[model samples]
Structure formats: C-alpha cells, structure tokens
Target: MTKSIEAMWKEGFVNEACLTAPKINDLYNRKSQNIVDKFKDMFDINIKAVIAGSLIMLIMMSFIGAPFLGIYIFCLLIPLIIIAKMELKKSVNLSKGQSSYDYLMNFNCWLESSIETYSGYYKVFYPLFFLGMAVQGIVSQAGGKLISLLVEVLPTDIIILGQPYYLVVAVVIVTLIFARSAEAIYRWDLNIVYGRQFKKLAELIADMEELRK
Candidate 1:
C-alpha cells in the first residue's frame, strides 16, 4: 500500500509540473508580447515622424541640390538607408513569440544598440550634408560668392598659406558641436519614444525571475 501511495505521489508531481510549465510559459509569452507590441508601435511612430521630417529636409535641400553638392551626399546615404532596413527586419523578428527571459535580454541589448547606431549615423550624416552644401556652392558657377563671403567674414590675420585658418577652425568647431548636438537630440528622441516600454520589459523580467525564485 505504501509503495502504491509513493507511485501515485510521483505521478501527481509530474502532472503538476506538466500543467505549471505551460502556465508559466503562457504568462511569459502574454506579458512579453504586450511589451514588445507596445515598443514596436512606438518605434513605428518614430519612424513615421522621422520620414516626414526627412522629406521636409530633402525638399529644402532640393532647392540647393541642383546648384550644390547636396545630391552627392544624399546619394551616399544609401548605406544608411540599408542599415535602417536591416534594423527594421531585426525588429520584425523581435516581435515573434518568446517565452524565455533571454528574449527580453536580447531586446534590451538591441534597443541600446539601435539607439546608439541610429544616433551616431545622423551625427555623421548631418555634418557631411552641411559640408556638402559648401562644396556644392563652390562647384556651382555662382559658388564664388560663398568663398568671398567666408573671406569677408573671417579675420584677415588668420590666413594660412593664402587660405583662412580661422575659417577652417571655425567650420570644424561648429561641425563638431553640431554633430554632438544632433547625437544628443537623436538619443533623447529615442528615449522619449521607447524608454517607458523598455522599463516595463525590465520590470517584467524582474518579476518573472522573482517568481521563479
């Protein structure tokens, strides 16, 4: 009778584990999906906003594109566009069901990486664009006006081998400042969009781990 009772107890524990595993998995899936869905939606909104803003920028550039080097810089941006596409695909995969903590962990890393890469790209993109505008002006038949203007504005004493050292220094300094500011702004915008959702995911991971304990 004791042996039969032990056998029954063993079967009951196995059944309990079988039932509990799916329940825990379902909980993880449902909670993770809720957070992931929200994050994806937020990213989509940012993308739309960015696209609209970029169109406006391109429209403004078109005013000078034909007359300047803007078109070349714009053309060079194909790689950045490709990177964005790859990141979008990565996000699409991220939206799939994941019942383990590893999913959230992967997501956390991806979020940081995405924000850094996207922001850093724009830092390079913006300066190249502004510099391209200068090159564009110089290459255009009407471009002498810009060089003359720079010479007229910069101090005469700051000349280096007939070129204005002060102007070069000023442009470099300004571009660096602009690049840093663009990076900061991009980082802030991303944080604004996805920060809350990321925090929620972290919380979910913490809670789920605690329950496991």
Candidate 2:
C-alpha cells in the first residue's frame, strides 16, 4: 500500500536514467557529426593542396630540366599524388559510419598514417627536389646565359674542380644539404598544413573514447 523512502529514491533514480538515455545518446551523436565535418573539410583542403603542388611542380618542370631534373621532378610527384588519394579515401570512408566511436577511432588512425606518410616522404622529397636545381646549375654552367653573362661581367673560370666532375661534386653537395634539412622542412610544412586538423581529430577521438566509457 506504501513504499519505503529508500525504495522511492531508487525507483526515481532508475526512472531518470531511463528517461535520459536517448538524450545522452543524442549528445554523443553530435560528437561524431562534428568530427565528420572537420574531417570532410580536411579532405577538401588536402585536395586543394595537392592541386597546388601539382601546378607548382609543372612550373618548376618548365625550367628545371637538363632531362635529369625533369625526370626527377616527375618521380617526386607520384608519391604526393598517392598520399592525396589516400587522404580522400579516409574522409569518404568515415562520411557516414553507423557509430561515432567506430569512426573516431578510425579517424585517429588515419591521422597517424598521414603523419607517418609525410614523414616518410620527407626523407625522400627534399633531397630529390634540390637535385633538380643542382642539375640545372650543372647543365647551364658551360655555355648557357649564366656562363655568357659571367664572361661579359669580367671574371675568371669559376671552376672549383674539373668541368663535368666539378658539377657532379656540386650536385652531391646539394643533395647532402637537403638530406640533412629534410626533417626540419617537413615538420615546418606539416605544421602549417595539417597541424590544426590533426589536433582536432585527436581531441575528437579522446572525447569519443570517454563518451563510450
């Protein structure tokens, strides 16, 4: 005919939890949607970045070649294009997953791979990029405008060693310089381009983990 005070409080607590469950789920759901928006925007940015890189590479190609430089620039661009495609796939895969937590975890990993990919590319791109310039210097030094201008300006031979071999030595020196500098340059570029998105994705992953718990 009557309930105890303890029983009443327990029943009220259970009722509140039951009533609030859907709202709780809805709140967590917003986290996933927000993550999706951030990642989609990131994907678009990556696409634009790749296109811009391609244009710059094309411009460089117009000037960079003694054949060796042209070939090297072409080779260097292939990995960048591949990374761009992979980034797009990551966004598309997460676009409409059923569970927020699932996609957030996936996105966290995707971000990690992106960093790894760029770091790996760094170890490759910087040296090769400068190699094109070195080759141009070598090819143009003999009879091109640079040499002609030097003759007109009043100078002696600038050869540090023999002709062809000296130029080869210069190329080796340029390659070594960029090899040492690659990590710093790569990190700088990475910070500029993807730093904000990486941090946001990590935070979303953390929030999703906490919410699921």
Candidate 3:
C-alpha cells in the first residue's frame, strides 16, 4: 500500500508540473504583447509629432524670410529620418516573432552600418557640439563691446554704473545656463536610450530561460 501511494504522488506531481508550463508561457506571451503594444503607441505619437513640428518649422521659415534655415533643417533632419526608419524596421521584425538570434544579428548589422555612417559625419558633429561654446564666447565679447560703445554715446548721467561690467555679468549667466541645460538634456537622452536597450536585453534573457525550462 505504501509503494502504491508513493507512485500516485509522483504521477500527481508530474501532472502539476506539466500544467504549470502552459500557464507560464501564457503569462509571458501576454506580457510581451503588452510591451509591443505600448511601443507601437509611443512610436506612432513620436512620429506624428516629429512630422508636424518639421512641417510647421518649414512653413514658418518660408514666411519669415529664412528659407535657408529651413533648408539647413532638412539637411540635418535626413540622418534622423534614416535612423528612425532603421529602428522602425527592427521593431517590426521583432514584433513578428522572428528568431531572437536572427533579430539580434540583423540589429547588429544595422548598428554597424549606422556607426559607419556616423563615423563619416563625426568630424562635423563634434565641431557643431563645440561650436555652442564658441558661440557663447563670441556673444559675451560682443555684449561687452556693445556696452562699451553705448557708454561712450550716452550722457554721464545715463552711464551711472559701469555698463560693460553689468553686460559681462549678464552674458556669463546666460551662457552658463544654456550650457548646463544642454548638457542635462544630452545626458538624459543617453540614459533613456541605454535603459530601454537594457530592458530589451533582460527580456531576451528571460525568454531564453523559458525556452530552457
């Protein structure tokens, strides 16, 4: 009788384990579907906003006698469009349940291509980034010169305080504020992108674990 009881318990445990696998799989599938749906909504909103903002800027520039600025904006925007297209393609591929290995291989290839393209533009981008600081310096110096010229033209009563000193102080404050804000934005974007990538990697690892089980 004891032997028969032991055999029954073993069979029950096997049945329970077998039932749990499908439950776990269903849960994972539902979670993955939710994530994909969220991404789709976000991507749609982002693309719409980008297109609308770009069109508005283009139209405004034409009316404001700044058509050249619009053209420059288009030139800068093309690379971003290409990047978005690549990312969208990858996202679609992932959503289709393509094999993870294949998806990763394609993603790596896309990244390599992007890096090559960016390498060609690295010279220009680096200079542009530093140009902000250069511009700040030029603006501060110009402010000082303007203040000096104004002081010369004004009557002594109007020049009660040292104008150049005040102008320099104002320029320094503006420049520092601009620099700090730009740096903060850059860091925030970097962190957000990195975090998303990390989350995707974690999900892939979990999927692999499920497969192993």
* TM-score to native of every candidate shown: 0.63, 0.64, 0.47
Model 1: per-residue Cα lDDT over 44-83, one tens digit each: 6656655555555566677854623434554646556666
lDDT of 2: 0.65
How far in Å is the alpha carbon of 9 misplaced in model 3? 19
* Candidate models: Cα lDDT each: 0.65, 0.65, 0.52
Better-scoring candidate (lDDT), 1 or 3:
1
RMSD of 2: 7.0
Write model 2 residue lDDT over 1-213, tens digit each, in one string: 686654444343334344435554455558667766776676777767766776676667666445556556767877877877876676577544455566566666766677777778877888978876655664664545664564466555555544444445667887998898888888888778768866776776665455443
Over 1-213, each residue of candidate 3 has an lDDT whose tens digit, in order, gives 344644443343334344434554445445555555565566556566657776776788678665655555555556655655666665566533643333444444554454455444433433444444344334465746765676687534432234445444555576555555654554465447445853774575455444544
Query: What residue pairs are clashing in model 2?
Result: none
Give the clashing pairs for model 1. Answer: 69-136
